[model samples]
Target: MPQDGPQPVERELPTDEARDLLGLVRELVQREIRPVAAEEEASCTFPRETFRLLSHSGLLGLPYAEEHGGGGQPYEVYLQVLEELAAARLTVGLGTSVHSLSCHGLAHFGSKEQRTERLPDMLGGGLLGAYCLSEPASGSDAASLRTRAVRDGEDWVLTGTKAWITHGGVADFYTVLARTGEDGPRGITAFLVPADAEGLSAAPPERKMGLNGSPTAQVHFDQVRVPDARRLGEEGQGLTVALSSLDAGRLGIAACAVGLAQAALGEALVYTAQREQFGRPLADFQGLRFTLADMGTQIEAGRALYLAAARRRDAAKPFSRQAAMAKLFCTDAAMRVTTDAVQLLGGYGYTADFPVERYLREAKVLQIVEGTNQIQRMVIARHLAGPESRS
Candidate 1:
């Protein structure tokens, strides 16, 4: 998902088409999404229709191939779109990232036939998706997930619970991870599961701090049967698929974090300039201006960090470590910047009267999702110092 703050400097797009696409996105956000962001979020309402509208606009499939009904944009372009969405609302931004993550396994690892069969609908068919890997007992240690998917003739029987699921109850489909063999990472396999499959159900959405417009819940698969054709990749290749999805998903989160920070900074700049104190605008004060400067610097650094990683990804280079670093740096920067945004607004930021309060709350979760910042550090350390010492 995305972050908030600061005015977006002019972006450097590679082509006129890319610039036009961004222009459309900005117009859509300004007219449809941003106006209702606060009200819907305060009501904890999921904007299903808005997502459907996004699907119809081809905004949901920007990063996939054009042949499959996708927009075929590079990660560089796709990510800036995410940044713009996040600046409008974190729920919409993170939802877009998670939707892309849900499609990753099938897009990258499915057979040619599977790609031809599934990609079109998944990319632009007005369907929302969720990625299922984390369970109540297994979060960071996804290798130990207990979800089971036993082969049953032409189908597979899935049974388990997935925790912290975004769009858990309302997703049209799920890219699920389940055990199909011996325990540990090797046993896991990815499966495409229809949301309405028999025995599939969702727990109530969790009470969360921010992005209340996005629902998070637990999903249960009780002997849910999926066809063999739905399996993604080889039987034991699920971990590969999962990790690869996360590698890309981490970059999405980084972009969202920067966006959220930028949004928060924008709000702060407006407030400080209009707010009067000591017979002068708050912007005229050195202390708050220095704070604003630091906030702007953090937002820019985070944007640069995520964009650098996006470039590596677009170039087909090995970028997991850089992705991890970007995820870590951008999210941490979001946490700091958004918090400062609230502080800059003083007591008003502490209440629902201002959106900066919401930005701060949303920023906390970025440090946790798509792998915690701690996990990102470990991933980066592994790339640098070699894998963790087992002793």
Candidate 2:
């Protein structure tokens, strides 16, 4: 594969319209996203304008209902588009995924009136969003979150800090999960808190090892009041909403992992082909050739895994297990493939001159985000052997 930039992804689109959509996305990636990705990411600059451009292009809401101003694309189509964007830049790809996850509560469970009132602006109205579930102490055990949302007459007063929140300081809206009852799972409730809500604030962005172009920070809701109309689903059903959103979000993460691996492999292939070792090109050596082959194989495998899960979702099947499997396997594959990429590039790969090193750093986060790979394994095991037995 040529590595001037992102190579064309071999997609299996279902229709001419889907094909056209992919074409449009690729053109946008080339023209708007790729050129500035390295510079912006290096400077740790969040590209809010790029998100706006995607919103205007109807990309931010691709997998939701068109009646609510989404693109109405299937998960399969939407995910391939994600893979393409991630190959160009992870900040935009993963940011769009978080936005989609934040929209899930309202899109799937909000009252019809609420949908009519807010879905339009949210789906494509140039609004950025963040999903708040991880608390400082409750990263993997999300049910243990300490954020509280107590009812005061008609409004719910929220008070707590959400940790590791993507788009934290910049989001126009936040999908917050907070405690409303007793401890454990049933205590949580989901609410859509506008960024301008009283007492809502964000701490400075975290100094992350990668994806600095996408801000991750702690969002503080200090007695923030949310109207009852903003509540999503039934009371004490927030964990369900959060888990369901994560099921889909995991697939998005899987696709992005595959894309990153593909980018790394492409870079490795290009570099090996040009670099001379002894009397021959590095690619001519059997040992290095095997590494390249393994990387390519893993990337293709990851792509297939995520696409299979996406197809099951589009078909309205029970795909939670498949989604977990995809997330776990694809991200692990990405870590392996990206590491091999760095090895193949030798000393230059260790440097920031090439994108492979960045890919390696970025790939590490994918294994942790959405849900840790360990959590994904637990999810898959639960689907197989049933929920864990608590003492």
Q: What is residue 73's positional error in candidate 1, in angstroms?
A: 0.3
- 190-233 per-residue lDDT for model 2 (tens digits): 99999999899999999989998999999999999999999999
Compared with the true structure, the alpha-carbon lDDT of candidate 1 equals 0.92
What does the lDDT read for residue 255 in candidate 1? 94
lDDT of each: 0.92, 0.92
lDDT tens string, model 1, 10-88?
A: 7888889999999999889888888889899999999999888888899888999998889999998999999999989
- TM-score of each candidate? 0.98, 0.98
- The true-structure Cα RMSD of candidate 2 reads 1.3
lDDT of 1 at 344: 86
